[model samples]
Target: MKALSHLNKYLLKYKWYLIWGTTFTVISNLFGIIPAQLVRYSLDLVKETLDIYFLYNGSRLQSNLYDVFAFSILFYGLLILAMALLKGFFLFLVRQTLIVMSRHIEYDLKNEIYLHYQTLPLSFFRQHNTGDLMARISEDVSKVRMYVGPSIMYGLNLITLFVLVISYMVSINARLSLYVLLPLPVLSVAIYVVNTIIIKRSEEIQRSLSRLSTFVQEAFSGIRVLKAFVREENSATNFTVESDVYKQKSLQLTRVDSLFFPLIMLLVGFSNVLVVYVGGQEILTGRLTPGNIMEFILYVNMLTWPVMALGWTTSQTQRAAASQQRINEFLAVKTDLVSEKSLEREIAGEVEFRNVRFVYPDSGIVALKNFNLNVKAGETVAILGTTGSGKSSLANLLTRMYDPTDGVILIDGIPLKEYSLTSIRRQMGYVPQEVFLFSETISNNVKFGMPEMPQEKVEQAVKDADLYQNIIEFPEKFDTRIGERGVTLSGGQKQRLSIARAIARDPKILILDDCLSAVDTNTENIILNNLHRIMENRTSVVISHRVSSAKLADKILVLDEGEVVEHGTHEELLAANGVYRELYEKQLQAEEV
Candidate 1:
């Protein structure tokens, strides 16, 4: 019960539906019980009225009795038909209200989880896998829905039937009712024992499924790498191992269900045998009529379903509880980053980091130590560094992808914490080292950052990124669909597309973290030349390994091992005979070759 506490609020949202659904289920069960009584009465009528019709033909008693018998059968048949029709109608309403509500809850829950995913910091994604998250959103939510829909309604139906049937049986003959109900306590104990195992196994099954989903997602995402390395057979063997584990867990759950459900049926069968044996003697001694015994048997037969339902409801409830626990665990995660205040004034792109230090959460190794720099409006500052020198870390802090472990970062002299994340980030355009593009049209991908931009502005951004001519070469031009991660486009084209997307926003600050690395040096020069005019009034941060690219910046800062080694214009750094000079000379020699 504690496992399902998280779903209470969502269930309350549809309380009216729940009320009506319960009403419909109760009515349906009540109607379903009526046919058994009608069967008993119709049989008794035949026994009482048969002799009169044959012995006294055309007499008043005969005529009246015959008419009564005929009418009873007709009424009995009509009642059965009417009950069936009414039960079907109400059952439809039960499904509409309850089953549909479950689907609605599923929709709400999935959306909530998706929104939570968006709000989580990068560290959370680092800790969780894409496939596991996908499984929770899809499969786990579906399992919870089973409890919300069928388990709830069916459990209610079973209760209604038990109350109505048991009360009627007790009224007919309390002795027989007591004898027939003897096995139920035993069945209850069995259900409890089996359901405990079911719950544990269900949790294991869900976890195994999550692992399987994660494996498939990873395998497909890295399919190219695997094929290039000729690891197809190895991947298959790994997949088979995971698949077998899921199968074994599933089979274990099925085995438990197999044992428990049949045990319930056997208990029901035993109760029927008891009623027949005890009531047969009562009929012989004239204490109970044949019709009375038959009615009791009919009532017990109706009780069988509730008995069977007891086992099913228990199993499904346990499974749902397990799934709910997993979902709640995920939803309970608190993000490390949040906005404490919102700045109403727009950012001017005067970025400064004062005595900043950053250490990754997972590694606990400092990526940047005592990092300090300031870029005024209308200036371009290029960050040049070796791998792991925290070039990208600076861009991350500026965009609020991460916060420094110590000290402050400010945009226009205001602390980053004072501004809302979106407010500060909205002013900045950042292109990461690795670019990702959705499966969408060329134009759609370009306008992803600014969907409502004028066509002329979009075209200008494409031209400025130097990707316009290549896009025009496609048969449908901007309308052409790029495959997943822009697999349909060349490496250089993908990077250019990312640049165009960033430029489409016309942000006050632009940070390109090795975005144009895939393009040729000539294309890189062309793109940088185009950005020169655009960077004239806005601050720009370029993180690059190439000295040729950084040479265009107003100031070039060289970083080594997470600390700044030198800072100056390209010519001044060259004359200083430092790290920048060493990199420039090597690059110049490489290009000359």
Candidate 2:
């Protein structure tokens, strides 16, 4: 119930819808009550006319009275029909206003969750799975919609009908009305017990569903790997286990949920029996007429549906509360990375790391320690390092994907935090070691960083990355749809496509993090040769394991165990005969073999 309080703002936002829907509900119930009264009046009128006809048997006046009674009964039937039609029309209005409001709220809520997801840090994503995140936005939101729309609408209908129908029953005869309502207290107790059980079971069911969704999502995403490992049988068995858990949880909930209607009907049946038995006693005592008994019966039947719907409304509300609690959990998370200032001027691409130190928050592993470097605007610097030598960590810090645990990073003499995150990222192009591309056209993937890039620039970017020939050979050229994660392209082509995407952005600072690892030596040389021209006036950082990639840089760095072991120009480093020289000689031997 407390979790559901979060929806109050949405309720207030669409207050007019609620107001109109309530008005319609009241009018519909009013119209519905009129038909029962008409039935009672028609019954009593028929009885009185029959008595008069018996008194004037065989008289011409009796025939005149018969025609009058026939006309009156027809008029009553027409009036009842009109009331029912009006009731139905207003009920339609109730759905239009209330249900439509719920849909609008659903749209707003999903957008709000998605927008919040975009602001969350990469670490947050690491802590959660894709399927759980998707479930919250889709499945959880749908359950909430049930509470706001159908449950609320039916609950209102229940209240309105009960008030009108019960009031009329009591006014006609209080004692009989009391007996008719005797079973309602028992119904109330049953609902309370069932509602408590429903809340617990509903939460369990939702969790099971989330686990099932995650299993299916992972299985499909990693299907290629599963096939490669020949683990199809094991995967299917795991899927069956997850499915069985979900099935059991659902059945448990359904078993409890199944009790709702039967209990409601049983209590209602008791109320009907009481009405007939008690109303007969009243009639025998001459305190009630046959018309009165008939009208009471009509009123009881009127209350039946609403009373039955009460249990369903309660169950829906409980499920909604459970789902809202999950949604609120994510909504309450505050992102750790906060932007301090907005950049008003274009970046000059002079990057500096002043005694920077960093540790991965998730694993508590130190990736960098006392690292210091300064690159002037438009300079090319190549960082050479083995695996786990903090080479990628440097790239991560430059992109502001993670802040250093200690020390400061500056761009153009301004602290990195001083600039707006969006402004800094917009001016920087990064090609990561692990590349990811959308399942879109080749041209769209190339223009991913800048969607409005011109065709001429797109061609130039592909040419600069030395991927123009392969793309032109494709059937659709730039328009070819690369499958999921660029599966349709070869590894080298995918890497080159990533480079083309970065180049198309025309960024002031470009960082290529071992992006050419997959290309053959000849292709790597060709791409490097083109990059020498492309990187002329832009600040670039080349992170790689190859010495050939560093030969053209103005400066080179060799890193070992998160610390710089050697730094100098290529000729100077070769003359020094240190770690860089050793790596260069080893790579030269491998190429020769």
Candidate 3:
């Protein structure tokens, strides 16, 4: 119940819908109960007229009274039909207002969750799986909608009908009404007990559902791997286990849910029996008539559906509460990447790391320690390092994907945090070790960073990356659609496409993080020759292990175990006979062989 309180704002937002729906519900119930009274009047009129007919049997007056009696019964029947039609119309209005409001709220809620997801840090994503996140937005939201829409509408209907029907019953015969309602207290106790059990079971069922969704999502996403490894049977067995767990949990809930209507009907049945037995005693004492008994029966029948609906409404509300609790947990998480300043400024690409140290939050691995570097604007610096030497960490910090734990990073003499994230990212083009491209046309992927880029610039970027020939060979050229994550392209082609995307942005600062590892030496040389011209005025940081890639840089750095072991120009580093020289000599021998 407390978790459901989060929706109070949405309720207030659509208060007019709720107000009108409530009005309609009340009117519908009012019209509904009137038919029972009409039944009572028709029954009493028939009883009285029959008695009069008996008294005037075979007399001249009997025939005249017969027509009047027929007309009276026909009039009451018409009134009952009108009441039913009016009740139905109001019910339609109730669904239009309330149900439509729920849909509007659902739209707003999903958008809010998705927008919040975009703001969360990468570490948050690392901690959660894709399937669970998707379940929260899709499945959990649907359950909450049930609470806001059908559960609320039916719950209100139940209360309204009960009030009208019970009040009328008491007014006619208090003693008989008391006996008929005696079983209701027992029904109340049953509802309370069942509601408690349902909430617990509902939570279990939701958790099982999430696990099942995750299993199916992972299985499909890795189907290629599974087939390559010949693990189809094993995967199917695992799926069966997850499915069985979900099935058992659902059945448990259904078993409990199945008790609801029967218990309600049983209590209702007792109420009906009490109405008949007690009403008969009242008639024997001349305090009640046959019309009263018949009307009481009609009223009890009128209350039956609402009472039966109570179980369903309660179950849905409990499920909704469980789902809302899950949603609230994520909504309450605060991202640590808040910007202290949001001013947009032009980045001159003079990047500096002053005593920077960082540790990966999830793995607790120290990726950088006392790392310091300064690159002047319009300079090219190549960082050479072996695996696990913290080469990629610099790129992550420069992009502000993760902040350093210890020191400050500055761009153009301004602290990195001083500029807005959007401004900083917009001016910098980064090609990471792991390249990702959308399942879109070649031109669209190239122009992703700048959607409005011209076709000439797109061609130039493709040429600069040395991928122009391959793209032109395709039937659609730049318009060719690459499959998911560029799966249709070869590894080198994918890496080159990523480079073309970065180049298309025309960024002031360009960082290529080992993007040429897959291309042949000839292709790499061509790209480097083109980059020599592109890097003339722009700040560029080329991170790689190959000595050939660093030969053109103004300065070269050799990193060992998260620390800089050597730094100098290529000629100076070769003359120094240190780690950089050793790496160069080894790579040169391998190329010669």
Error of 3 at 259 (Å): 1.3
Error of 1 at 462 (Å): 1.0
Each model's lDDT: 0.88, 0.92, 0.91
Misplaced by over 4 Å in model 3 are: none
- What lDDT is obtained when candidate 3 is compared to the true structure? 0.91
RMSD of each: 1.7, 1.7, 1.9
Model 1: worst 10 consecutive residues (lDDT sum): 336-345
Which regions of candidate 1 fall more than 4 Å away from where they truly are? 51-64, 284-287
Query: For residues 264-327, what per-residue lDDT tens digits would candidate 3 score against the true structure?
Result: 8888888889989999999999999988999999888888888888889988999999999999
lDDT of 1 by residue, 427-479 (tens): 88888899999999988888886778777887898999999999899999999
lDDT of 2 by residue, 1-593 (tens): 89999999999999999999999999999999999889989999999899998999999999999999999999999999999999999999999999998998888889989999988877788788888999999999999999999998999999988888888888999999999988889989999999999999999988988988898899888888999999999999999999999899889889988998888888888888888899999989998888888888888888888888898989999999999999999999877777777765698899999999999887788999999999999999999999999999999899888888999999999999888888899999999999999999999998886888899999999999999999999989999999998989999999999999998898999999999999999999999999998898899999999999997799998899899999989999999999998998999999999
Ranking by TM-score: 1, 2, 3
- Go through the candidates in order and give the clash count of each: 0, 0, 0
Better of 1 and 2 by TM-score: 1
Cα lDDT, model 2, residue 75: 100
Ranking by lDDT: 2, 3, 1
**What are the TM-scores, per candidate, against the unseen true structure?**
0.97, 0.96, 0.95
